[model samples]
Target chain A: MAQAPVTTRGRGGRAGTWYLFLVPALLLYSLFVVYPLLTGLSYSVFSWKGTVRDAFVGVDNYVGLFTNEAFRSKLLPALGHNLALFAGTMLVQNTMGLAFALAFSRARRGKRALQIIFATPYLVNPLVIGYLWTLLLSPTFGPANTLLRAIGPDELAKPWLGDPSTALPMVILITTWQWVGFPMLLFSAAIGGIPAEYAEAARVDGASSWRVFWHITLPLLRPAIGTITVLSFIGSMNTFALVYALGGSSGGPAGSTDVLGLLFYRAAFASGDINAVGTASALAVFLFTFIFGTTILLNRILRQGEEAM
Target chain B: MTPRRGAVMVPLMLWGYALVAMIPLFVMVLGSLRPTQDLFNDPIGLPNKLYLSNYTRAWTEASFSTYVLNSVVVVTGAVILGAAVSVLAAYPLGRRKFTGRGFFIGYFISGMTLPGHFGVLPLFYLLDGLNLVDSRLGLMLVYAAGSVPFNVFVLSAFFRQLPGELDEAAALDGAGPFATFRHIMLPLVRPAIATVVVFQFVPLWNDFFYPLVLLRDESKLTIPVGLTHFFGRFQNDWGTLFAGLVMTTLPLVILFGIATRQIVAGLTAGMNR
Candidate 1:
């Protein structure tokens, strides 16, 4: 389409009104987002006691984040937990989500109900999801334990969230259950978009269903897979409300479910001191850099994969 | 991908997963309906009788009524503020071919995927300095700002797709740019705006982190944050909490059920299309 010439937009001076239209959203967005982003960078290098900055600390806060025992202990483990959560989603969320998507796309009946059912868990607050699951997984007066006891041994009904080893995994599964709907919808739509001819032709060639899925369906889903992977990575990394609800702000049961967002909260607000603010700011900056860089790298890889396909 | 033939196991697996997935929610509904005593005494058994008191208790004693009101107010305000500004901004970028148009579009688009949580400290201080930290209007502003990127992104793309004859026809009819936009263009983009709102509603409604840290007053808190405090206060009232949870989630579920097709379309709008 040819560009609409400027003079055609208005009789004479009215063309400038477009700039007027841009101001409200731009001002709100800039003041809230662009400005703080810059300030966050500067704040990372300075000590702040609540709203007041006390001293400039160069890279000391960043250094301290990696060195200070107070943060170092939590930071590494939190990072590990984030990665573990990502891995778990890659396993559980991806596989189940794809299966659900495939099934939904194939089924001739109740597609609307299936979509709604799959989508319900994700519609509520993650915090609420955490709370609901907490009640379900409660050792006493919880149906999950009762069912486990009746179906298996009494030992099978052990506290799900109370134990350290199980806490993180439980959180991961709950996270998966809450989020799988969205990616599933995406996958289902993508699968639906694929022309049936490719798979039909493959079937005519006597290819097994697995063979057709592997070569035709999976290859066609490369973009969706890449997009979901990147999004899931970011989602897991930024997770806080779920962890905060299931485990306390400390990410407890022994800090087994601790993650970067919680660590940021704990560091920033724990003392409300100037140095703590600086340290938290430093961590934020680091997280920003890490996430931004990795996403760029991932985008590049995705583009390359698409081109290769 | 469709296979000509499939095993019975596939449908069985799907149905099994669906049933298992519904268990937690079913349990929540049952817990809400039955008495707390029944919940504890007959953990795995049927409810002896229906007890509607849990909903009333949660509504009155737990203060979820006020919290829901606050949530509705904030979410509606944010959606309006976000949508209004986005529509205005998108028109200029989408319809006009002025200088630095690309720059402005790029600026809004840059924030599309950047999570704004990392700037909490700075943002808090920014709002505090502006005296907006604990205010409802402040929360609305923050939510609005957070949504601008996505709203502008989608809305602008929508605006760009309109036929150029629209502007020409409006211009010939002696309508100025603003008048044209208000009368002609606005009516056309209603579906896109609705789509944006539907897409924005879920995240905005479900957001907990920002409201928790930003708002301080008890009555001012939204449902998610308020529910946490309610849980703390009524630690052992599992039935009441379940009622609160159902109250919080049920309306949304019902809404989605009614508008399932539109919601699904809005959600999958970013996919292969």
Candidate 2:
């Protein structure tokens, strides 16, 4: 029941004419993605009153992100938190995921069941994960405090999510916890893909196991390492649902967990200003530039590192 | 001694990680089954008895039934239509070498790296202009479009992997491109398409960003958005919220149980691309 816009203008009877198959998807993509992207860029330059473009404001909204007192305070922390989230993920996830992958790749028995367990948390919603952590860490009634008090001292069993000092780090840890399986899985697959002979040859040379991993296995898994790092960077930059679920839109506990995602949501929707659209669009563009720019930069460095390896 | 240490260490690390991983789920499942009063009283203990009432309360009183229906509709709509479009798009892109072929591949592949937030604000307005704001179809279109770039990238690789001789053989037998694609090609890449469908399904099902921003109607909210609303309304009742969380997550948990292989394969395949 699908039409291909028949025309008798090809060399090979049916298979010769390409781009005909591209007609529908390109049309839909252009209508949806390409168009909105351009218009959104245009919106970043214009002042908007809800839906209508009011005036061509020419980067004032962008300027406001840094100079405006109210916006600057929020934006800077949100940006810092995003970076902190990235660093935390890079350190914790890479170390844990890589360590776990190194172990799991050699694992033979009960691998499938273990795979299911590692894969389960990431399968669920990140927002739901946030809620789970919040529930588990509630100071008054959360099991974390209860268990801590049971094991250690009462003072040590302080509020996890309620205290500003611990909120962002806790959120970052919980976020990393939910996603640690993915990199673990990725690294395991990459490790498995490496031929058996490389390690055998190293061991045949009387190399230590740690040396085998450091010298032979790691260099080969460079591409996978690059992939995981980039993915983690992108994922952390778009940190919204989890943070929102944990700390609410204000990213509470004195905004310790405030992030660019929540900031954009506030600028775009929650601010209740008539001119919110313009500023929000500006934030969207800014987020895009920051995320896209860093991603490109990161790939270049990673690629260089890959080459160096 | 070294071999023994390796054996013990690997199993210990993996099994230990698994136990820690299951704690949230264990607590969630156990927490959901207990009465709210009991949960607060003994936060970490086993429930004295199975309490099915919280599930019923979340299902009916919180209107999660409607939310789940809305989520299913949006997810199914997005995945099905997106897969269809991606299959068609991947055909020419995958098989034939033509001028600007790299450009087309780069264009769609670029969408994978580019964050979705860029177009969201204007996208909302664009949908509004089409009178689709707050509509499930509107949300579905956005999601469906969002899925295309990744699916096309993945599916195209799958399509490319099939031998070219099959296409030539079909052409010589008087089969048109359409028929060859339908009968021969579509079946060969069934695993790949399955992977794409799953990769698309999880994100779309879990997404709350679009629904939160573009949809205003409570009746039409997807599960994630509905979940936030449910939590807000029942802030005091962690039992009901836990129940909601369990109900929201179970389908995905079951999906993982069934398709863990496909998910892992998809991850590796996408990385290779």
Cα RMSD over interface residues, candidate 1: 2.8
Count of clashes, each model: 1, 0
TM-score of chain B of 1: 0.94
Find the candidate with the highest DockQ and give its number: 1
Residue-wise lDDT of candidate 1 within B125-207, one digit each (tens)? 88998999988889889998988988898888889899878778777788877888999999999988887777777778888
Instruction: Tell me how much of the true interface, by contacts, candidate 1 captures.
Output: 0.59
Question: What TM-score does each of the candidates earn?
Answer: 0.92, 0.89
Give one digit per residue, the lDDT tens place, for model 2 in A155-258. 98988888999998898788777889888888888998999998999899999888998899999989998999998999888888999999999999899999
DockQ of each: 0.55, 0.50
Candidate 2, TM-score of its B chain: 0.92
**Chain A TM-scores in order:** 0.92, 0.89
